[model samples]
Target: MTLGREDQPGAQGSSIQDGERDSPSAAIPRLETGIPRLDYILKGGFLRNGTYAVMGPPGSGKTILGNQLCFERVRRSSSARCVYVTLLVESHAKMIRHLSGMKWFDTGMIPDRIYYISGYTALRDQGLSGLIDLLRRTLRERRGTEVLVIDGLESVEQRAPDVLAFREFVHEIQGLSALSDCTTFLLSSTGERSHSENTLVDGVIELTDQLIGLRAVRELTVHKFRGGDYLRGKHEVEIQSSGMVIHPRTEIQFDTPQASATEDRKRMSFGIASFDAMIEGGLLSGSATALLGAPGIGKTLLGLSFLVEGAKQGEEGIYFGFYEPPPRLCEKARKVGIDLDTYIQEGTIRLLWQPPLEHMLDSLAEQLLELLRHRPKPRRRLFIDGIEGFRAASVYLDRLPRFLSAFTNQLRMLDVTTLVSEELDLFTPLIKMPSPELGNVVENVVLLRYVELRSQIHRLISIMKMRESHYDRSIREFFIGEQGIEVADSFRSAEQILSGQARLLAGLQDREGES
Candidate 1:
């Protein structure tokens, strides 16, 4: 690690005071990690001159995460330099080869801006002293070294004579980082190591790649961050071709909305006059409505109608679904007298169909919010075909309600009027919501159910709940035909309509008894 370089700012003998914790106020500066949403969760980024531990299982992506931060440091700033010292047996060439496939990896920056070295030889021969000496020399040799990553901290800990010796080594590393004003990341596997290294560090980032059922979900959490604030909890992480992406918990990310909807004072339509009349005009602008019903009961169609009508009124809209492909979705909409393809071609409407596969809940919500944020027009309409798709993809079932609440709040803040379809049991005598919290969180809920009367199945539509507004409470028979979705007169001829069976009301029953 010897490069007979000229004098650098922190070349082992800097004039800056040792053990300088960041300033007391929020004015404490940050060293940006350049990872999307990660910085946001970090409340800015890592504290300047902070030492953090990145711990996880062997295949939990800790290695890639360290490398990504190193490369990003150099790419984001010209004067930034990084040293990646691995104490593992893996050769530097193999690591570089693996990283080359990632979009951000740059070979040209190696050895110059970013230096990779093997610290195993020194650690094995000279023990802790030898490793510390090598790191000091690397910092002195590489001018402008703002970032240093010590990968495979476990190897060094294994070589430590005892926990006391390992704690001393950890203290030495922290001192070096603090004195030199360089952010340091110590990478190691997560477990009950017999070392007090965690207490000596400025922060701890723990990653977990757990197999829940058949799905492998990766999550990240920050256990400790000194002199800095961050969103606490397990955030979803994914390793893609572009590199590592951390999706902060949706509920936490948008706990408070960015902006409010402009249509709060007015109403919007669904292109069906009778249905609009049923809702007293349309749903309140920028409100979320749960369109609940059983399968094959026109939930998706009705949600699409909401977006289609918005598009027709010169409002931008999106049909974000997971069950159908875009072509099939457009075709289905057209079959029900909706010119969905035309609106899509005109750019007034978009069909975003994500296949029903393993998906990160935060990632799905992030994408939808991103699209809504960049729309060309305000008061945009969004219809999620079935939220059950998200529920199926969720690794944590209990998080859906809160996640949906935050997500819905975010949509409203973006001035987007969203309609999410929720499926009930195929047949049931009781009216129940799969997510009871959803009914209370959203501003409105429209119930669509199937009723069997005289050997016929009739589709019924009614507004179950509406807040801050008035709506027709009568349950009406809705039909989807060439004339489009139409809501006719109420179910005046039957009782117990919601029980999946139609029965004669008291008056009619009395007449039958008399006969």
Candidate 2:
């Protein structure tokens, strides 16, 4: 009798299968893991009836990932059963107690749709052969088991006398999974796998906990997937009470498409009329504008005004800040005659605040992407109050440029007019940017500085760069008052406004002398 399609080698239709011609409809059927982002990374989901290895060190979320998968499966299909065989001496009660904390864990499905069995006693008594026999008998008794998860494969490896014995044990489970059409998961603490063990599995997912300075970061990498194209890199993984959440690296999440044929030529206001005139009507739509200045130079206030203006125009705005909390920011806005609380209450604005410290760059990117994903309309205004905050959070300083480039490109693709504020050194006369490469990423640069004129401190704003747009280059005097940020005429009387100490121009000095 000819074997059915399901009985063929690589029954899940992995692309690695030799000489197998699968129809388009029969090509790599997938079973969703009930994880939205993980499903996206897997190109839909894991191949049905395929054996995969979830390899990671202890406390690296190996057990949680396995249990989450099992619970998700049983939750969807009441009749579908998952056999969870624990090979380690860890108590089943202890495992259940831990899983109970996750939101996805369902106590009603226990013992009915999901069965937990102990293989430790059997493996301890009769060795590798006994463990294999136990799995075979369990499969035979529990007919129609859709999923089989063997937790603690390292325990079985410990019992095996040699490498060959361990290989035999893996082969037995592989054969059992194929015969029963059961999707199998083998959990191992160590990332190391023998040649046979690696070749026998259809895919391998590795989880790691890395210490980058004082921060401990959790990352997940798809080391191998025989028939699938996964986002290849160290993607960020966060283990929360909800479950294991994976944040695919921003650099690889979306492909940068060619420039759109329909360009947005509309300009947006800065809410300060004179400031808008300096920037030539205002910033162009979808352009990235950098607000470069020292601390307390009205950078945050300008960003707030930008958001308030967008909110007034019925556009949605987001403020991703690191310095001040939401309430403090709202209070500050009120002091400047901008009502931020009203916009926030009306659902036109969102404030996301992360304290200044060592933060995972991927985590921040994920948070921003999550907010973008849930919004009903496209975000019109985005105020990243602290670009330097992201720079400080990055463990690898060299990668910051690439991250920013990807991030800015994504913002442009979404048609978001972005304002990123960078804190410059107050004492330094020479202008310093967070990164020199940033000049290439942004389309505009607005410089705010404190200039000393005859011992009196004054504030000035200038348009340093505006790509493909016309703007006033003259340094204009600005002030912060009860009406918020107000810009006046350029400091035409001074010669060294950019020097941080303005002196009278020779012509102006001569005119004053004549007077």
Candidate 3:
């Protein structure tokens, strides 16, 4: 949430203004935590001298985030100094030992750059007054103390005699931060902002680890970022060996995609001429297409053809899929004479294989977008095989509509022609659309089905819909000969083509009987 300059720190006339300098010529500076996407969520990191409360329950990664910030502060800047003061009696050695596994932890920065101390003794003996004096003296003793982390703010809160005293303690910490020109991070085990400590701080970053049904989801939210506007929502948060990795929600992140200036709305081919003829040459440039078919059908093969075609034309492409890795996927393409390995080796087409086990929807989208951003050229094609991979990875299945809509819209605006493959029932009498919103987001829908004709099974290809372009609707016999998928003549004599019960039309029957 964004706040006015008045409500935030580092402003000229802010309510909790930092230090004595109110010079008009000066600009409000920021202290980056050096964490990935944390600065992005903070809209250019936290205010330089701001006091932000990092609150969460136990085991919610609050401690890791706090320690990460500490190491990052010193790691990024040589002159940066940090002080980690924990009110809990847990030994700093144990904390250091626990953090040794993390990729960001630097052992050499101890004592000199980042000081680890205990506030438990001071808080227990002399109370809040004594703790405040200790911090004041520490900040003074360490001259370049730019970062201060109070690990057990909840302990300080519980020891306060009343709410007013707790608020006063927070206010005093804020004052000390401003006087010392330090960005303070108060890590507490209080997830809710019901206490006075939340509102008294410059910002509140909350991390929650909760079970949604059977799956445990960890989310991070910037409840209050006083200085500037941030992407407001529950973002995906993960704790790995490196540190915290955050993925801002797709819909919220690309709410307004930057419109590309390229007006080159040309057809993007799938390398198959006859199939291209059926869909009005090919899919319109910068348009999304839904390649819907049953399992074992040519859905995956068709997507590969599209990407391979782009790679042949010197246009960059990305194959973002879940099930098949690069090796297996290239082998599958080789069966159809689609030489994907050559283009892949030449750095024209990239095969991004993501395993379909326990993944985040936004993370996949961001990963694809990151790959796409590097290639600043037009005619960029993306083939997302097994679109259900996204559905499977999402916490809420209902969010697929909004997410796909935003995802495809952003790709289109970037002048990328996108194709997504979704599976249909193998042998059903009626075609069940995979999703209600899948067709709505795409500009074209290609239906591939198996038709039982004359006591034999045959594959038929047809274009169900193509927006803003005239497409051939005749159902053609789809065959996979030695050269790959070839679109044959339409089944003009057969009626009820898609129902798997095709019969000769009355006129064609009569003509056959007469002949």
- Per-residue alpha-carbon lDDT of model 2 for 220-283, expressed as tens digits? 8887877767768787777776677776666766555447512845788978999999888888
Model 3 residue 466 CA deviation (Å) reads 1.3
lDDT (10s digit) by residue, model 1, range 33-108: 7666677777778888888899989888898888888777777777888888999999987888777777777777
> Which candidate number would show the highest lDDT if scored against the true structure?
1
TM-score of every candidate relative to the true structure: 0.91, 0.90, 0.91
Each model's backbone clash number:
0, 0, 0
lDDT of 3 at 413: 75
lDDT of 1: 0.80
- Candidate 3 clash pair list: none
Which of candidates 1 and 2 reaches a greater lDDT? 1
lDDT of each: 0.80, 0.78, 0.79
Candidate 1 deviant stretches above 4 angstroms? 1-25, 193-195, 257-264, 504-515
